[model samples]
Target: MKSPALLGRITAVFRQSGAMDKGKGKVTGVIALTLGGLAVLAVLAFHFPQYLTTPDLRKKYDVAILREIMLVGMVIAGGMALANLIRLRNRWLNGTALALILLAAALGGHRVPVDDFPDNTPYVGLDWFILDLLGSSMIFILIEKLFPLHRDQPVFRPGWQTDFTHFIVNHLLVGLALLIVNFAIHRLFGWMVWPPLQKWVGGLPFFAELFLVILVADLVQYWTHRAYHEIPFLWRFHAVHHSAEYMDWMAGSRLHLFELLTTRVSILGVLYVLGFNQTTTDIYIVIVGFQAVFNHANVRVPIIFAKAPLKWLIVTPDFHHWHHSSEREAIDRNYAAHFAFIDYIFGTAVKSERRFPGKYGVLGDYMPPGFVRQQLFPFTWKG
Candidate 1:
């Protein structure tokens, strides 16, 4: 009974607005709980690396470094929880955090050893999801706070649960998504690969190859994105993303699974056919990953991006936000993912007197809420 009550309190705290009550220790309590919870998950990941970790990521991770990180996280979480307990503030939250930390320590904490494990074990990308969530929150949240457009918008704004669920599901299924994309690419586009062209393209200077990669990929993305608006069936799949009324870093993750799979297959398929070097492709992935989150972030750039020419050359938050706008001037426009110029050249850039749209989301706001329902939306949607 006490455990259920504590859990309920934690959930209520999370569901509340992001504004912190430092005097009540609510801020520290939340941090303690978050870090302590992640520490427990980290321990499990360490204990069951074969089943919990990503194979590709495992190859690159240094166990020593990860161990040190885990140690620091546990120490901070424990310290915060203990401090709050001594102060007798937010006792339920801090108590729960301490309990999680103790449980993690009891289960071997960060000291859990990793021995030999079999290759190709079927696994969800739990490690990937955890690390990425931690990293993205630290980086993007800081940026949004420093250069905020919607100053009143809280970090845990309304609909954050939906977006966070999307992020978790998409990341956890990264293995499956890669598998599907690789299979489709090899089976369907293998013959399209011209060796001489691939060799030539791969041999280009690194920057040149990277530029070409972005250009080619963004072109495919532009057309695919436009189709999602111009075609009724495709719009249903895309509407799940546009249903996010609030713009933030995590909001970009609210994509329907079908759209995610098809879009990745289409863009990566073209890149595969082109046969760019692995290094260049890796760099492009990093760029795309950063921009995807950054452009959706509730951030405002004061000077450089205010210029029209630069906005046309690069996809900024201002530019991408317009694509998510419900206003008539912005509807079905600004489709390019990386290069804003792609939209301009295609005559799809938004024409507006206002600096930003007054409203966002689909014009009619027809889409349903929640993760499962949104995924099922594309299939069941009548309009």
Candidate 2:
């Protein structure tokens, strides 16, 4: 037998050689595939502008739909390529990466020309989805990477099906519901004897009016959100939102449609009563949109600063994560929408030294996925 030192040296050499070979192989494969894919996309973009820019071709096909199709396809292809690369440890998956690059190019290539819309008209729906939701998704992803709430949790995991469904219904489907609710509220409020109310509210300065609108809306939302927790009748619809096991940007979109409509109508009632200007109302919506999603995100802010002055003005991730927690103490606290001060003033604030919740999701994991079941949940006795 070899001496102890010699045997140790041999083992070390074997381990080092294997690790080095694995590292080098992975690096080489990633680089070769990425570069080869980008080169092909560059060539196609330069030579085949017609396939992308031709109006006749685009008219026959809805570019937005096609873009979504290609995006999904590319994502699947990239996933498969990455999986195969890991499984085989082979450079041949470079071709699969090239296919992904081409798919990505196709998705981005078919934007309708700026001149296609009338000079004054703005693109809506999918254009807004691409610009706003996609941009927000990227920002949230970056925030999670840079300032993760739970460092142990994987940032991008395999549990996105529920989150994706939530996003689709909450962001896209809710628009129609909001429109109907807004119209109905306005008509109903118009018949009321609040003529003087509008005149007074409308006379306020723009910034002041905007602040009031937000405050009023948040007040309504504060109560509505609280009711969703306190009232078992409403908890069913609300539980669907709390069903998310992980918190991220899209997590806020998991609310049930009935819950969404009820909450929105309450806020809209406040808006109509306050007679907010369209511009101010629009700005308020934008601010609330960012706040609603951001507060629920899995981001870590510096504790010292976040708990100090900032805590009074705006709801941070720490404040909102507690709301999502199933902890008994955190159950009814932090009910404020945009401001934590509301919770404090109302005696509902629950303070914690820990930044992130140990556990999330509803107290009992009873809710099922899908819109219809969630809508009917509030009335059912299964809670």
TM-score of every model versus the real structure: 0.97, 0.69
Superposed by TM-score, candidate 2 places the C-alpha of residue 201 at a distance from the truth, in angstroms, of 2.2
- Residues 2-95 of candidate 1: C-alpha lDDT, one tens digit per residue: 7788778878875665557558988888888988988998899999988888898888789889889988988999999999999999889899
Off by over 4 Å in 2: 1-108, 111-124, 369-376, 379-381
Candidate 2 global CA lDDT score: 0.65
lDDT of 2 by residue, 93-200 (tens): 444454545655564433323233322222112323333454686588688878988765544333445565666555444335656686878876656637688888
Q: What shift in Å separates residue 297 of candidate 1 from its native position after superposition?
A: 0.3
Give the whole-model CA lDDT for all candidates, comma-separated. 0.90, 0.65
RMSD of 1: 1.3
Predicted structure 2, TM vs. truth: 0.69
| TM-score computed on alpha carbons, candidate 1 | 0.97
